[model samples]
Target: MSSVRRLRPVWADATPDPAGRPVQLSLDELGTPLAEVTFVVVDLETTGGTPAECAITEIGAVKVRGGEVLGEFQTLVDPGGPVPAFIQVLTGITTTMLIGAPPIEEVLPSFLEFSRGTVLVAHNAPFDVGFLKAAAARTGHAWPGNKVVDTVRLARRVVTRDEAPNHKLSTLANLFHATVTPNHRALSDARATVDVLHALLSRLAPLGITHLEDLATATDPVPEDVRRKRTLADGLPDGPGVYLFRGPGDEVLYVGTSTTSLRQRVRSYFTSAEKRGRMIEMVRVAQRVDPIPCATPLEARVRELRLIAAHSPRYNRRSRFPERMPWVRLTSEPYPRLSVVREVKAGDGATYIGPFSSAATAQLAVEALHETFPIRQCTRKLPLVAAPGASACVLVEMGKCGAPCTGHQGPGAYAEVVDRVRHAMVADAAPVVEAHADRIAWLVAQERFEEAATVRDRLGGFLRGASRAQRFAPLATCAELVAARRSDDGGWELVLVRFGRLAGTARVDRRTDPRPAIATLQSTGEQVEPGVAPATAAHPEETDLILAWLGKPGVRLVAVDVPWACPVRSAEGLGDPATAVAALVRPRLAPDDGAPVVRLPGAGTERELDIAEARPVTLELDDARVIPFSIRPPRTA
Candidate 1:
């Protein structure tokens, strides 16, 4: 592509590019002076503070520009209901006073028109604006998306406790010596608030806040030294990407991603829109920003996770230590037992199940498996055949384990039990679901609803973990998978995913052919070898992110080497155990090209499945000398 057609970041300034495209600049790039800005001080009286539950009874506003009052708008509204006694006493506006007033439907149009294209000002902005917004919604009127400022917030920043005891409109009115005294009526309070706004602006004037943008952030708790760091936001790409905030000596202080303009999002940290104390502190020590531009928002988010994990910046709390996420591993030893581990080795030869949400949830899933199949509860490394003098544990007495240590079960017999769990981890969870179904239904029939619900949750966790593992395994070993999605800008966002990792990405302009872009992507994309199954070459969380992107609406699969297939019958959606058992054994639709076959344990039938779509797959569990550990089915129907 020529330079004129090359993709440019959205935040590039309006200076015409080689293509002569006329680009418009964002507000922060070209600021408006406060003297030229219109501010409307508004106040409202309502039945209550809850906007959703309350009704607006009155509205008052004064429009000013350059400290000169241009106009005043006032209206009394019939709220369509009686005013509460407490509210009537508080504002001195009764139901009788509102009887002949125009309804909010009549008043909203005039008020919206009067406040159009101006910065809204109020005592407590959310309280006043919230009422108007709620009224607009209730009356089906379009509310203007205007800038808002609260005089109370402004006073807190500009006026100290030495100037006033509290930052209230009434208290500030007394301090500022307003021309009009606030008597709790709408117009009177609005006029007083206008005076307070002017007084606060006068105090800020000495600090050189003469622009609307400066006024917008003047009330933020950010210190002046930190505010001076706003220049760090300049020169970042104007499109979706990850941004790193660097402290002195170039240590990364924070990692963030923006699907919108990187400059715009980075600039927000220096303004009032960013209110987190930790972030404000991060911005304080930050000296510069580094941009990592991406072709798609999904790639940006995935890279954000990877960077957070790689850097483990002190400021980023989550995704900093994904390695700490626990996984339930069915150990590969002779007497295999399920174990919760924080790490996975590629050649361990052990079957793995999850990087579960939490260690607790992973343990619950293990217990669910143990409850259904007597895999083993012992952590001891038992020999293939038990020694003559080896002893068994209490669980063996409880029939929860086939004690391989004492030769009660041989490796062949033990493997049968372990195989059932292995199946649940990677293939089919039908056995686990079927195992829990009868006990759960029996408990429900016995009026033990809580017990049944516990089993249900445990079963759900195991199913989710297993299904997640199954879903991630296919893409893990796939050498390459190229896909594309439509971008919001009428362009195409192309991605090169390798072993579940984002190897390369490109965003094409809508007017350009995406074929050349895709060709460039596949040739220049990072080269990655397939990693172990389940996790593949990328982190499970990262794979989850990629899968999410692939699964989004309008994602087109350009090419792939691996056949994407999962079990058509998942471990969910059955009303009862019998139904689940029946659902598990039913023959699934199979691809004509010879997919894998699953032999249902005890069902005495083999079923083939279609792997074209990679749905959920299941397996049957076989336990020798099975003793009922579950609540035995009740005698009742």
Candidate 2:
């Protein structure tokens, strides 16, 4: 394809190639600015194809400033309804997954905050960027107007087409020999893209793609005004509430919120003559401005929280310790028990709190509630286990106990205390809702229709929030119970549960076996029984060699372990010294022309599959079983 036809003229000043076709530049030829530009690597998993037609299921993006990882943001969005089965499987996001998640209206703001003030980077820029634009348009916010770098195009420029058979993310990962953890997860994939960027940069270093601005402009154009606006946003409100700035091309220079009056505060940046230069420059980039009026101070606080958590404006601070936050999770048992744990273990049950840093912090909170509510912390499993003869133990001796452990307190009485403790933990929501409802009722009775309508809105918001919290509590617990990323003596392990049952586990094995094969190789260079069919006239070799032994007997899982040593001295010049083998047995293998058949453990049936895709292939019967296989790539010179 010609360069002119490949490049789309999306910008006003975009010039066509010499042939009047779109131009597609390679990494080596494309201009990159090393200084004065920041890049935001982004990825998103959604409900359907088009952003207008579907909703975002998950979003993960990282900001890079000065070629270093400056910040990151990731969240599982509540797309608000059932996600298709294929999408759920592809993204690992289920309909049950986002039940109580905050809606897009709230989530978009947090996303913006992370993406603000930088050029976007993605594998296929049009796909991700288009979706984002559509999402912004759907919401009340203006579509994001920023430059984007498509890594797919960059990869094509960095190496010969033959070097990478297909330019998929997986293929590039293999080419770079990149170590990507949690492969399908949004964060892990984004990290891999970043690595690819660095590798491509090294290859294209001589192409004048070194500077930040040059690279940014080379990939996509950024109007000069957007830069000035960002410069002047430095003094704006740091509190939670919305702020809107207009720029060129219906450009939403920034959509954000501050905990304080960000608008009044932002304008103060232009009060001085010296600051006017920067303010004027920002205004030149922007075209309009607006703000939504907030009712209560608490509502303002929450709105700011929603915006920061959503838009992640350029000036907003990145999350300090998102995974360290505490959350409550319900155990996957007959009677679900709540326990406190950290966000890193979000998929684990046992309601979490603090993601609070220390046990003392969590304990202090429990104690504060205990002082007011008199709730028992003792185990209900063996209520009398605490004391030998007495009805109650030391807890009763102290003023802190309601004495439920010994049955001294009835279930009804204990329940009341438990309710109070729960309130202390999350703060009571009922009272707030009831108060708002009461105010609305008074307004209605007084016939103040407009005021009543306003009060009704407040009440509706509170009720809706309560409903979401209830739904989320259960769904969050379910997710926690069904999946978990754990660490064992061997290495890392991922557990998958089904309907609260431990279904399977995927683990990495670091050990390798050393042995040689006693299995036979046919005279015509294939593994088969003698005289089953007419043999080939030519035979490459009849020698016997051994390969590694690996297995995962617990589940339909894939486990790969690097081979310890080469099985044969003759198979040396094949490139990688360590070989890999994989095995999958199900639904019996179909008849094929050249595939080798491997017998099942019980001699029940046979299965045919690729040796390369198999992690463990059975070719021998020894304890340190070694499978004989060729390590040669067919000669084509």
Candidate 3:
């Protein structure tokens, strides 16, 4: 659509307004009062649909502040080409009538001057802005990064589709009773857009969106109840902290933490942009927000974890199932075995390995331990006396087990192996590493290269599991530990930890002496017994949380009441387990010497086979025991 009736006489000379003022509001000033914002509603009548092929026929703009027009600018430009007959008929801008109009080079600079220092507005803004930006680029003028607002988006949020059949400029102008009708003219459309912007702003006022950022993001589909409940965030603290949304009955509807202001983060939920239906429902029932001020972001994170654990808030999905976290435990019996348990029971004498995120990981750790040592795998309680005439299990016949249940291995000897398992769990893993190396070497010597690689990977997995266990072991055994990090505001954020649990946290003001605050925190922090079972521990989840926090950069160890060290020969000395495992498993060729190592039908006896190239072999022993094997070639120099 176009206008063909533009016939205004051209001015003699271009008189550009004084250069546009720079936008006063910094990007961070998103919360700036809307009433004081300068908005420039702009419209362009173009020769065609896209900027690449189109030239501006006319430019029109109205600058307003506080709903009052401050100025108006309008000008027609020469396209330097013939206006199509259809476009001339549609817009009333005849080619003959535009004979001496000023070109875009003159019209663009004045328009830019008029729009300076204002947030640009238009119905479906990109079309108008795109043309202006293109013109500025072609004219060797810098395209100022002006903040833009699209009335179409604003209308979508304010006026429902039911209120207006569509968001077209004419439809919205008619619905809002705009002062100037949109009749395919640049000036008239720009004026209509100005009115629509005001109408949308009025709708936003009741929704508590008085800030520029709020209006920009207001098109998000927010529920009516959520919009009304925005008052809950009005008085919230603007600082790093944990916030809880509580229902009328005071039950926590949701819990979260923010490194920035709690008020800003909580207020974000009230806007139409919050699309999570669950969050919207929570906000509807949320009657108040409770902010727990934290001195540091880390402290807020810790508190959020603990609160979510304690309250099991319906909206909080993570850390709520602390009880479901798996722990790798050594059974408390004459023959100890690694097992995954959900609860860490007191007085069980079982060494607990973790509150692993999942049972699969805990099982992996257990499997690693079994691969590294001859720990008992049986669940049955054994007597000092062996049952007479009992048949041995397959593991016993295959030499995988010493058969402690049948007294093939003495209790004293088995206890020594159990002691090594315990040592590997917390201190030294040298015995497991040495044993794995020896086994890998033996397999390689026997021409079982694939089995050797498998052994190496198993050992790597065990070492990694052991390394992680050792890292947490010291913290779990400590009576108390204090750690600190520099806060964003140049203050110290201190945390008091006991038995691997976050006992208390405090943020010291930059101007205040930290010693007093530290002392107060130390006195008030919960005391926990070192090595207590998780069921009886102050906070089982805190150990993992603290471990993760310590892993982050810039955290400093402030103080410790107990010995804080790991064994010098611990598994952590093992390099990246995955890299090590991959190196060991990589396929390599072995020298061939013709020999019948293992018989396979349809394959010649002269075919030399490396262990990696061997097929699976199952042997049925005389005692009815099955042993699986990978057929290997004879070793050759």
Candidate 4:
């Protein structure tokens, strides 16, 4: 939890050079290298004076290939203690800003990943590159294999500058007319440096900067500190496997694989920060890093999944485990068969069709199937039934079934009917619904109103049932659903439901890490992070509210949906809806207020009613009477 500056190791620990001074490159060093070699421009913002005395505060890099900017990478590191006062003010970084940033050990892995396979570029190459080399040495990383490009020296060569007072980044920015925003902030300063380089390159292309080889040897000035740390990375072994860079909070800064030379590959982030989105994010989060060397690429690939699944780190994209199959159980006695729920199970051979994420979904699917075919819901055919002679059940009495429990139908006929029902439920609904619609149309055309009504009811039921059933299967794994009802106060009441359980109930998706989420719910970043907030009584209040209404006792998972006007408020204003509802629930005289108000159905002693649940509650103003509200337990519940 140290600030970004505290995350960095002492200069002697992570880099060879104690002092981060500037260096220059000219066309002469380049000799005859190609026009397009992968290049990475790097920069470091650090506590001042010397590398040995100070620490790196930030690392920023921009990668270029064939003169095109690829991407950017950067991270703030704690410097192992309080940042120098001047440093904090200049960088707009404070102790509070670094509270959650990781340390040097955690950042290295991500840095290494970003640095892989590119020539290092920097405006004053030696100054920035030297510190990077020093840091790498502390971590036992080799100097990068890539060569360097110093725009400082290149600019000197191109500009014939007798008039220049200094060879600073600002002077260069001014010379080229490139807009420079901030000077001390690593990322911003590095960007301005890149712009300066681009301008210098444009002017110097005719002066030998056009060719990569020609630009290498061009030197303007050199810092003694950079010269000492110039030894390329050494003793690196090529191996395949996952590597981790540990930081503060035991944070995993980066995860990566390598076929060879782990040190060389990981050291490049210091030399190059710009690469890809993943690499950049990794760099920003890294602290201290380490590698789990693997014997082969295949082994590395395998271990990657295992480790990723186990840790559930912030940067990984894919899941570690394959999805699971879901199934449903029917308790009736025909030896109690398990149905493979297609959406839940797909082809996974799950014996039951419904471990649906929710009871509501399961009911809908079963109902849809029942409507499509003459399947009896009698307990007699289910394994869950108490006895073979169990009564016909409510489904039969409702005329939803053909009464197959008694002598009305034989086992063979009934089993066939069940199979048909299962098929319709499992298969696409388009053909089945269309066929049923046709039957209803034919019956109505023939003036068979009774038959048409039956068909009409069944068809309507099928659509509704199917729509509801589909909500659970193949459900959004981490998202929750929100239901909103309008209140008379021109406001809306919200209901949040846990959809993840449905996915799990169906056993379609499962998490290897069972930790409740935390970071995502509190994120103020551009995008929401994954996982749920840690289970806290205060969190997920909406889910708890719904469960309370259901008379179901347990901690609830909450999801919120609110109107744009109330962006941050939860559904019901975190259970304060009663106050607002009082305005809408009043006995109303307005003609428009007469619109049907479907209050949740509920019944209990009058004393049990909350202001939110009160029926016929009178508003003090105008003696307004609120519509009666009701609550009903789900039929299956």
TM-score for each model = 0.65, 0.30, 0.70, 0.30
Task: Output the lDDT of residue 215, model 1.
Answer: 82
Write candidate 1's Cα lDDT for 1-637 as tens digits: 0011122212222234355543322223424546558888899999988988888998888887655577888888898899999989999999999988998888888888888899999999999998888888888987889999988888877788887789988898888778788988988898888778777776665554545767887877666776667767656777889999998989988999998778767877877688888998999888889999976788788889899888889999876666777778888898888888886678889887777888888888888888888777878787775688988888887778877878888889888888877876676677777667666535533545567667766776777677777777778878899999998879998988898788988888899999998999999999998776777687778888888888899999998988876666544333333344334433334323343334332323222222223432222223221111222352211
- Assess candidate 2 and give its TM-score to the true structure: 0.30
**Runs with alpha carbons beyond 4 Å of true place in candidate 2:** 1-32, 216-637
Shift of residue 442 alpha carbon in model 1, Å: 5.9
**Candidate 1 vs 2: which has more TM-score:** 1
Candidate 3 to truth, TM: 0.70
Candidate 4 versus the native: TM-score? 0.30
* lDDT at 585, model 3: 33
Identify the candidate with maximal lDDT.
1
Shift in Å, residue 416, candidate 1:
3.3
Of 1 and 3, which scores higher on lDDT? 1
lDDT of 2 by residue, 1-637 (tens): 0011111222112234575533223222212333235677788788887867888877777666433466777778888788999987887888887888777788888777667767888988888888888878878897567777888887776667779887887788777765553366676777677667666655544443444433432332223334324334433343334666655564445554443555444543322322444445555656556564442222343344444544544434434333443433333332223444453232332332222334444444443333334555553443323344547667577666756555576666665655543442333433333333334333333434466444434333323322222322322223212121222344333333211122232333435211111011011112222210011111101000000001133322222222122112111211111111111112123334454444322222222222332322322211243333322221110
On a 0 to 100 scale, what is the lDDT of residue 525 in model 2? 18
C-alpha local distance difference test of each model? 0.74, 0.45, 0.70, 0.46
Error of 2 at 457 (Å): 69
